[model samples]
Target: MSVKPQSASAPFAGPFALGTLAAADGPAFPALVDSEEQVLDLRTALDDPALTMRDLLERWPAVLPRLRALVADPGAVRRPLADFRVLAPVEPRQVFQSGANYRQHVIDLHVAHRAPDDERPEEERRAEAAEIMDRRAAEDLPYVFIGLPSAITGPYDDVTLPAWAKKPDWELELAVVIGRPAYQVSAEEALEYVAGYTIANDLTDRATVFRRDMPQIGTDWLRSKNAPGFTPLGPWIVPTESVTDTGDLRLTLKLNGEVMQDESTKDMIFDVARMVSYASQSTQLLPGDLVLTGSPAGNGMHWGRLLRDGDVMDASITGLGAQRTRCLAEES
Candidate 1:
């Protein structure tokens, strides 16, 4: 006996999804989707004239049931994805990025900055870093930073390396999109506030990360990480209901055709719920707010190969579609 091949329309391809998409000549619009190959045009499905990702998220409680029904109905206005362009799923009102969240990434950073004359065995150095990370996770709060909305660009857009930037780097992260208001939420209840997840390339200017002018003030993230087009975000938003495990996802990034970062979210020092709950303690996270879970190891600083003009980066997380960005030197 022979088995039959599965078709694109089959249920085995995984559950359906929703995304923000547009035609080649139009502005972004909300969508109900099946896969990259099949998109069900949703502008008419939604009666609102100004529908957007933020709009969907704000009305998530009411829209979710309709979305599920649309997922089952196969006769909606359909179009091949090749005819449409994907956009950043949401225009966030606030962006919060978790810093130093991966255990192995932290260890690599510590080992990279050893003193020239410091002579410690590799095993000893590794052990020390691990111990510090363990203590930090147990006792310390997650380090969260604000990101400007102006820094966000479409997933396939060109990223210009500012003329003043010398050591630009790539940090691909898994970012959670908030669907409901969250203030003073407990860690155990935090996941309920999430709308979905998407991919973000949190581009950084490594050389300017620290503030030499005011050592006391320490890091200057705005100058280093929020330059125009620094955050290349989204090909699609994978709804929270579709994702069963936030702690286990394979994330990978490539420069041109060569792989640079390949790691799992299980390596995170602080998991997604902890980061969201910790962030909400101080800030009111509204619908469309973005909580960026930090990147894994294999950044430019760790690899000794920083980003430059003419390089292309392809970053992806499981289920959340991939993003491709081309780098260019800023024009004078």
Candidate 2:
């Protein structure tokens, strides 16, 4: 991923002084690049001896000062953001994805939304549904699951099919990128430590997802959810400051420009604030960590379908931007 030379005049425009390119002018990044055309390898850039996450945050008051100077010259050092291959914004030691955290997601669960009548008493059904609703409320415990970090891929990367899988699905979700170490933080204090948010597609295999062919109650969720390139994020991280309200934002998914799934962040079962707080209750969330906030309704499998080869899926949020990925057939 070679860097492109910065231009004299700004290439894109928006807030945060993009220098030659601004936020609005670029593609909406779920992992880091807005689109393949404007991809950037931020990981390689950070790996440079001159920069580190610590330096970007606190060690140096001005992490981009040197880079800023470099960009200003345009002719010196490497190229601009338009030149590199986009990469996942975070390299987390572990990834966690919330399940059925949105109201519509619950409705989409269909039969799984509840147990058989004989298994659950009337009281139990009501209580369970109440509990589920509480969690989905903007003000309750946010359920989360550990996701396979290796499943992550860049914005424009391809989503591959898994062997023995009858169905493959795409879930458009709003992902939280952790900025710093946080432990047992309160909901009110959670957003302060957030680095930003990006669109994430929580791709899954249908068979393993429901443990349909498995013998045991617990299926290999990691294997089902963490296929290669299962997670597609970026096109750059939208700074937390730029978003006015994570809850009120509209989220939509399109297959080759046709809207497939569309909803608002306000429908989330657990809002970002509660999610951050609940996640930090036991473990420390480190910088460069990612939290996939679950998907809304309208997944492929819900309609007895799956993503086929050459299918292009693009997910977008109101202010955060968009991430597009092409679905490809698995090589035997």
Candidate 3:
């Protein structure tokens, strides 16, 4: 799909910085920028703004650095984005996620797959995720999974489950938006290339994620995430430049204001810098490709839980906006 353009004439009403944008005036993505928030819509903001994504890095070198400063200052973009209706910050060319980058998550997932009839030592269970851990010793390789580009949705959007879904669980994760084309990049140079960060809930249905019955079709991980409104995101992408410490950001998941998951990204064993450099070896990341850094330890499946109709879930990251959604039953 072709990327859209931003209207030159006040795309939004309130204070806004250079990169921030409002929705396309109607039933577009909701307004992320209001009198009280700092937001940007990479899709809308990049729209023919006299500069392209590639242009910002070279021809208009000052612009990229300005964006970094604005996001960090929060208050800097106020005048340009005060009234803009916020939209998803980026229009990714590809979307991916790490499988066991965080130690706690590795532990939780192994526990979930435990056999009811047989017993294995916890060390044995962790070995599965461990065998490949060393691959990341040099970079983000060895522990990631490809997510369907179509599976991703804008932040603040609703998540719809398949009618046959018996389990809908949330995996709280932090996602990174790539800023440019990259291949064989070094970890030392990774952070400089990231556009920003956002909160993501990798919704899944384990019963269908890896089913053998679907031989006529294919592995069902896509089906698990491809349900309409499945991936809830938004608030907005906090430009990576603004975040000096991606390692320590706090993440939380709540249902009706009650905390369900609370942890810090600092626990990530692989971290963002390595993931980007490693992913670049094979996939060329273009502007807007999202890399969902793995989730932390707390998830519903750990407790035999799942989302039911009318359940409102909200996920928040330290600097990113909170995403809210209500799970609804699939249509009969």
- lDDT winner: 1
Tens digits of lDDT, candidate 3, 15-101: 322232443463333123433444444334444434333334232334565444444564433334434444455555677777677
Model 1: residues >4 Å from true position, as ranges? 1-14, 115-117
Clash number by candidate, in order: 0, 18, 20
Give the higher-lDDT candidate: 1 or 2.
Answer: 1
The global Cα lDDT (0 to 1) of model 1 is: 0.84
Q: In model 1, where is the ten-residue run with the lowest total lDDT?
A: 1-10
* RMSD vs true structure, all candidates: 5.3, 6.8, 6.7
Tens-digit lDDT track of model 2 for 1-332? 11111222122212332111223344322212221133332334444534333234332224435434433443433334544344555556757789877785675463345645557655666566657676548345677888877888866667777666667888898888777788999989999878667778988887776565666776567768888788886545566766778888777888877788888888787789888888899898877677888888788866666788878887777766566788877778
**2 or 3, which is superior by lDDT?**
2
The alpha-carbon lDDT assigned to residue 179 of candidate 2 equals 71
Across residues 1-332, which tens digit of lDDT does each residue of candidate 1 receive? 01111222212123666667778788888877775467866667777778887888999888888887777776776787667666677889999998899999999888877889979987889899999999998999899999999999877778889999999999999999999999999999999999888889999998899988887889999999999899998867788988788899888999977999999999999999999999999989999999999999999888889988789888888877678888988888
